[model samples]
Target: MTVPAHHPAPELLLDYAAGSLRAVQSLLVAAHLAYCPECRAQVAELEACGGVLLADLPPEPVSDSLFGTLMTRLDATVATPTPVPAPAGKSLFPGPLRRAIGAEPEALEWVRVVPGVHLSAWGVSAGTASACLLRMAPGSRVPAHRHTDSEMLLVMKGGFSDEFGAYRVGDVASYDTGTPHHAVADADGECLCLLVQDQPLVFTGPLGWLLNRGFRF
Candidate 1:
């Protein structure tokens, strides 16, 4: 299949390869991997590397009672109830996210913004962060903001700019706390991106102060 306009960051992809992402982050990356053969191939290479390393580990014989101890631990873990289905609201980009994130997802709760650009909260894990999709009109300026935690952007369509450079489709950018970044849409068309924010965004003024207090993600 053709690669989507955007690709997940190599770091994020690495995390996926390393199995280090949060459950939701993994889900989104899993969706991306499902569609992108290139990434799938990369992940396979990583798995191969891991296998080689595993092969280098010293072999050791197991003790007999180790099996009984492991089984007791597994039985305890299995006894807990499974998680209930997510409520109609509060679900974040359940796969077939495209099926759920769009002009008409009543659950999306689109935010009010410029006439052309659009934004909506997709995942909210509380004081830690949330995921969002932002669409910008040609030449629109996305506000400059200070990061309290990490920030990542995956360009899905069109392009945008920040102080660092223009990010076209397929480019992934990342920033950690204290970094400053901003964007303006491409001159020719609207830009849409998926953002997994690590901390609440801090605007440049009083509003930001209020937001900082109200929103930690």
Candidate 2:
């Protein structure tokens, strides 16, 4: 595994520790932590802090109907587990993504965004969150774009670089609506990344208007 050069923001780590982040964000964070020991340690510390804070809170009593209502809801709701793929030799893909995608990396059916770039979107809730696998060939570039909500990128293989910095395998690059930047894959090899976003992106470049029409980004 390559050492990560970037990581999720501190606020995100805090949200993750408190279980307050959305499922898509958690999925990206979990995938990053699979290879980032530095972040794992940070999360451990944050969890400890959360534990202390929780312990200090005063206890509250629940309504008499709370348990019955909870049970009723549980009985009414159905659980859908993410399908797991059969072992396909050894895979470098993260467990969380592998489960959600339900297949090995090579098995993903990617949609071409442009030459040398492709995407495989997951069926996460619409307008709430989105998760996908972005594969870029060596030297490929994603046109400059900004997000309406928070977005996170976790490199699974190879690497890419943006205005913020270079990111190798295991690195996580997190951004918000404020920053607009383009990314280019490393020249050495193809790059595979797990990308999670809460809202659509707003492309900002010469081709912004055209790209947005096609990608709805």
Candidate 3:
């Protein structure tokens, strides 16, 4: 696999290291880390810095009630063992994503949202945020759209290019609310990506208006 030129911003990495990111966001970052040695190293550095800062801080006493609650939760967890799902057959998906979806991309059912574009929801969400997989046929173009809150896309296969730039496998692209753009899959092959969004997308233009009336991304 080619080394990725794109990565999550420093602030996002810090939030990830601090365990502050939402479940869906963390999953996207973890998927990116599976393919990005550079981001992995950066995360390790952040963790080390966090540890140093923690060591410098004075210890705070935990309340007895809180400790007891934690102990009870641990005991209950041990008493009721959660079953781990069997691993799906070999796939191109990263470990984090494969574990989350519990199936290969090709094995999952896809729903067409538009011409040459399909989506498979993973049913994972945090508050208003949600996660899904997007598959685009070769040379297909998505309608222009803007995010309502925040959106993150991690390339899992092939590539795509937008107004921002091109993104290949392992690259992560983040968009803030109101940022408008459209992406076209590379002509050479299909594009598969993991998408995590804080809110649904709002489309633009004539085709977009028609799509928005009937569909919700």
Candidate 4:
């Protein structure tokens, strides 16, 4: 595989290494890390720094009841049986993503959102956030839209290009609130991307009024 040209911002990687990123965001970062050795190395360095910081911090006291509760939870966790791993097979999604969605991408039932665009929503516990797989047919273009909050896209297969730049497999594109852009899939092949958004997209095209009317993207 070609090394990805795009990556999560340094601050985002720092949050990921510190274990402070939201679950959905972490999932995207993990998928990107699987394809990015450079980012993985950076994360490792950040983690080491975190460990040093922790060592320098003073210890805090824990109440007996709290400690007992933690022990009980730990015991319960240990008593629980390990889940069986999914049978190995060919797949485009990364391990974190496959586990989150509970299946391979090909096994998902996609819902057509537009003429040549499909979506498969993955129900996960992300407060005020949504996670899904977006698939665009070759040469298909998503209508111009603005993000309501932050949005992150991790290319799983094929590629797409927007005003910012072209994104291929393993590339991560992040957009902040109110940022507007149009995306078109590569002409030769369909593009599949893992998308996590803090809020639904806000369409900014001529049909924006209709598309933004209670439509969840």
Please give the range of 10 consecutive residues that has the lowest summed lDDT in model 1: 91-100
Error of 1 at 151 (Å): 0.5
Clashing pairs in 1: 199-217, 200-217
Tell me, by TM-score, which candidate is best: 4
Tens digits of per-residue lDDT for model 3, 81-129: 6888676566889998888887887788877778898878554777888
> For candidate 4, what is the total of clashing residue pairs?
0
Query: What ranges in model 3 sit over 4 Å off?
Result: 61-89, 207-210, 213-217
Give the alpha-carbon lDDT of every model.
0.67, 0.82, 0.86, 0.85
Q: For model 4, how does the per-residue alpha-carbon lDDT over 112-169 read when each residue is reduced to its tens digit?
A: 6677888775545478787788899999988878887988899999999999999999
**Model 3 lDDT on a 0 to 1 scale:** 0.86
Q: Rank the candidates by lDDT, best first.
A: 3, 4, 2, 1
Can you write out model 2's per-residue Cα lDDT over 1-217, one digit (the tens) per residue?
A: 5667688888888899999987888888888888888989999999999989999999898999999999999999897687785666667787776666777768767777767888774445445788878899999998778777877889999999998899998889888766787899999999999888787666777877766654543
Shift in Å, residue 79, candidate 3: 15
User: Per-prediction TM-score, please?
Assistant: 0.64, 0.79, 0.84, 0.84
Output the number of the lDDT-best candidate: 3
Model 1, CA-based lDDT: 0.67
lDDT of 4 at 121: 54
